[model samples]
Target: MKDLFDYCEFGDLKLNSRIVRTGLWESEREKTGNLTPEIYNRYENIAASGVGLIITELYSLYPRDVFSKYSNTTNYARFVREARDLTDLVHVYDVPIFAQLGMVQYSKKTEQNIAIDDVSIEDIRKIQTDMIMAAQKFDYGGFDGIQIGLGNYYFLSRFINPNFNSRKDRYGGSTLNRLKIVLEIIKVIKETTNLHINCRLNAFDGTTNGMTLTETIEVAKILEKYGADSLQITRPRSPQFFTRENKEKNPLIEASEQIIKNVNIPVILGGGATTQNQINEILNTTDIDYISMQRPFVADPSFLVDWQLEGNGETKCKTCNNCYWKKTSTCFINRSAKWDVKSEIPKKS
Candidate 1:
């Protein structure tokens, strides 16, 4: 039987477990966009906690984008040096980490929040260039991979969705045309850096004319064909979509299984799961081998350690989402005591 703690292979990278930790907001950073000591401490605990892979909190492409205030920015002067230190720290635990790069809006000079279709060809090139530059920084900083934020409501997500992208140029209409922007970026990143490219994509946007499962399956295949190393299936409003009140079967599980069958690359089912048994059930029942979690780690970065020991562990995270809504890394409900970085060093088993 497949277990959550089983060591496995994700593409060329070997993992200690099947749990891939995906991060969102980062409120612990210094005002100047540099990584703080608290942030490093948190990551150290998580890295030593038995995660398979780590996708860092959103590294905003633009310093002034919508989610930038709640995220880390690559524009800081100390980025590479500090990032190198952070990557080196995680490497101590043998956890491969990826820098999550994304932006919610596109603004140039006076123009604010430009629509997907309104962006000029020059704008397109600039976006791609910025992404490529960010990938190079990740490479220079010793990162193992790059998680391109194509999921959620990020600009690139909307840029590829037919409902939001009504452009007349070569970048719109057909699925291949809509995906041309990302495909081109992937090709260049592959040539320029050794970083593995993992695209976090929407299984279905749940919109009238937006991305559906059928189209997402097609997108997954094209990404595999064009050079993406792996994919993580997510929805428009995730984690929220899978709430406590809703006892229905998760659509993402089925969606992820379908996407896995359609592509040759590694596929990760993002969000919704909260326990050891639940995760193992999904693993043994479906083709999905990897599962990603976020808030549970915020509640306790070392929760997986207990899960490994107890065998039937469930997260202490209330799923209150206060960490998400407040845009902080620390949990509001579960901060019983501050973690002592020096005294709490996790030893490998």
Candidate 2:
């Protein structure tokens, strides 16, 4: 029998399987972005559930604003310890982990005072240094790789987009001009340490005023040209960018198609792709080397593990995007909401 358990490699690291638990923003981290007992407990259970790679939430490297997405925040030491704890916990179960690294260039002057709109070239270099230091620490600890965020409101993406990155400096003019910082950051990480690099690209803005597929593809090509090991090109997501209707379609599939066609390196996709049939069709038709599941994994961390066993089982998700918590929290259709279930707890519980 063929190994339905597919295997793939990125740069120097070999992932045990191609199924990835997309770096999900569980919002369970400490207000300061530190690892919480809840977080370690959550992922420890997830690791045991059998997902090969657990790419953690989008983690801010800014020691101060590590918990920016949350209104309340924690201090620097607490954040680092929390990060270490999650990775430590994952290692015990022997699952490879990657930290999604990003910087905030959103807003003119947010509380942290480190917005991309205000970051100078020198400031960009210093931030790159901070990223390197952080990655080195993760490497020393036991992380498998570092995933780079570059699209939409991300600092690197801000610099990449002409609309957001309106500046006269070398870091923000033409395509090559804006890419100086990103290229520098990638070079620093590879030259300084041996950690695997995976570029998470915003391959399409899906809007009239933002980055087009052309711009994103051009950028992905550049990242590849510079020795980036792999690319995970997803569509323009986030309530901050697209509409509900656009979010409904599987933008990950389209972006993955564009990325696979442009780059020779391994590519991955993660978006509205939720079913076994959907994933299988994508793999058969496109060049995507991997399928990443975020919300589906959140809804049921063991979905892939179960798929491996049952080979096309029912998806627990209702395909509703209510999990996106801009204000309050709710789901499209959860156990408690159902009339049949008297009370709500995890089905597995």
Candidate 3:
């Protein structure tokens, strides 16, 4: 019988392991969104290390709306081809990559912003078309799928908070309506490409009046019904992870349990995924199809290989979270150097 970690179909991608290298960005790209060899090598290395699926950091769907300081890849002509090359490299390692896509909104708190009100339906159409085109290109480049990203919402998470999207139109009002845009985008991409589609939705806002698990689960069920290959869920930080502490209680984990009970498609839970026991518990205890590991991979891309092949207890990583602060995506305690590779895939004799 095939096990949970065994080769399985996730959306369009056939994954060999249940471990997914989730998105963590540190502006690793050049000024343009094109990927440098170093960045390609960084991801390819993780693929070689046994990450079943790789979802790149949130990449913009539109060209000019780039905001926030963290460097990222863009779909502009300058780097689009080179960005495709990165996907090709991952394919070489027998690992599938998903080009995580998103569009950012300027913070009204700042000097000025892209008023959601002013965004011409024509502009939205062009933007949606671009996303569809990008997903097609990712398929041409050998990627398995694309994960839709919610642009910096803590920057605007308050708006999606159900408390703030105080509007009369379709984009706002109800949680289902605010999320219709994402579902519509997925529909467009699916119509454009035959590749797998993975949709990521913010699961919790970490506040009472904010989007609670109830509303998110309702939305997730709809994504599953709409042919989403896989669904990745995470808690959107309203302020920052530094300010929010749930150590005494793991509400995120509880929410994951609730979601898994409702949906049949593979569900990925992101945020503070540290330690073997926690991951095992999610898999062993719930119907969660897989795990989305971030900081751990940054700490050591080989963390997957070591944990599985060596049977080494407790990831050598302390989860100190320094790599997170640096925003470099490279861990302080366990850079790729800390890994001592011993196993080799054998040649057919």
Candidate 4:
């Protein structure tokens, strides 16, 4: 069984532990979408806290593109000269960083939600090129890898999910057809860049007609075949929030175990995994290579640090889901203003 503190290797990434800081949205950017000092502080704390890897929040590849449909407040073209500073700062702690590159930048509730059936072949081609270009920029900015957002009803997930995708073209109909674009993205990135490529993929979405674990297991196999370095397994949020009954046992864990068995690449199993005992049980029992958490880190950036020193199984985060509602990711329990949330996004008068 893999121990939590043992060194881990995934492609080119080396980490001190099996713990990964999963990407959490922090709307703490300059209007120009540059990383603010406050964002830097949060990262520094996270890095010093001893998490194995840091996956930055999903960043829009093409902030201004009509097809991309990013939120006005959160969308900013990434990897500007200033953004390079973030990569540099995180590397200072010898922590590998992966930027989550999301093709269609939609929040759960807002922006233009494009139906998958409406996407055209030409648009798909254009997006493929754009994503590659974005990956190149991230490599240039000194990021360790790019985690493609292929989950959570994002643009790519919409394409992958048959319930949402309804086209009769080559990019639709069959499972492999839906996976072609992602396969292409991984192949081109491997050819063009030395940066590691991982994917944050939905193992399942808990909807009547949505994706299931069986299909996602196949998706993981194909992604590994296409040169993806790792897979971060997650589930799309249900229409309602998870209550005690559902949150205690994440259904994704069993699916992630199934995927890990099938794929050679490292698998990051995360979502609703809150305590040290739970993570320990996961690593000790399963073939899963790593564990990741988002809310625990937000509620307490030092959660790992505390666990390391004390060996306690508990986390400070209550998983109230309040952090998502705030302008920036802040723990309602702590009530500390740790980020600089830009109060007003300038309107075009």
Which is the leading candidate under lDDT?
A: 1
TM agreement with the true structure for every prediction: 0.97, 0.79, 0.83, 0.87
lDDT by residue (278-297, candidate 4, tens digit) is 77887887777688878777
Task: Sort every candidate by lDDT, greatest first.
Answer: 1, 4, 3, 2
CA lDDT of 8 in candidate 4? 76
Task: Give RMSD to native, each candidate.
Answer: 1.6, 5.6, 3.9, 7.5
Please report, in order, the local distance difference test score of every candidate based on alpha carbons.
0.92, 0.64, 0.65, 0.73
**Model 2 agreement with the true structure over 175-272: per-residue lDDT tens digits:** 87777777887888888777778888787665555678887778888888886777776654543323334546666677678777888887777555
Instruction: List, residue by residue over 1-349, the lDDT tens digit for candidate 1.
Output: 9888888999999999999999999998999998888899999989888899999999999988998899998888989999999999999989999999998999999999999989999999999999999999999999999999999999999999999999999999999999999999999999999999999999999888999999999999999999999999999988677666778889999999999988999999999998899999999999999999999999998888777666799998888888877888889998874543334444545
Alpha-carbon deviation at 231 in model 4, angstroms: 0.6
Highest-TM-score candidate: 1
Candidates sorted on TM-score, descending: 1, 4, 3, 2
Q: Which residue ranges in model 2 land beyond 4 Å of their true spot?
A: 1-4, 30-34, 63-75, 78-85, 92-94, 106-118, 207-209, 238-251, 326-349
How close to the true structure is residue 298 of candidate 3, measured as C-alpha lDDT?
Answer: 73
Query: Which pairs of residues have clashing backbones in candidate 2?
Result: 32-74, 35-82, 105-116
Question: For model 1, where is the 10-residue window of minimal lDDT?
Answer: 339-348
Clashing pairs in 4: none
Q: lDDT tens string, model 3, 1-349?
A: 3333456667656786777887656556777556766676678667877667889876655444443346464555755567567777777777888887765654223334555554455655665676777787777766678877652363234434565555567767776676665677778777777678877667776555667788878877877887687777776651145222435555556787788788888787665556666666666766666777777667666666655554423555465656556666676776647443325432222
Give residue 210's error in model 3 in angstroms.
2.4
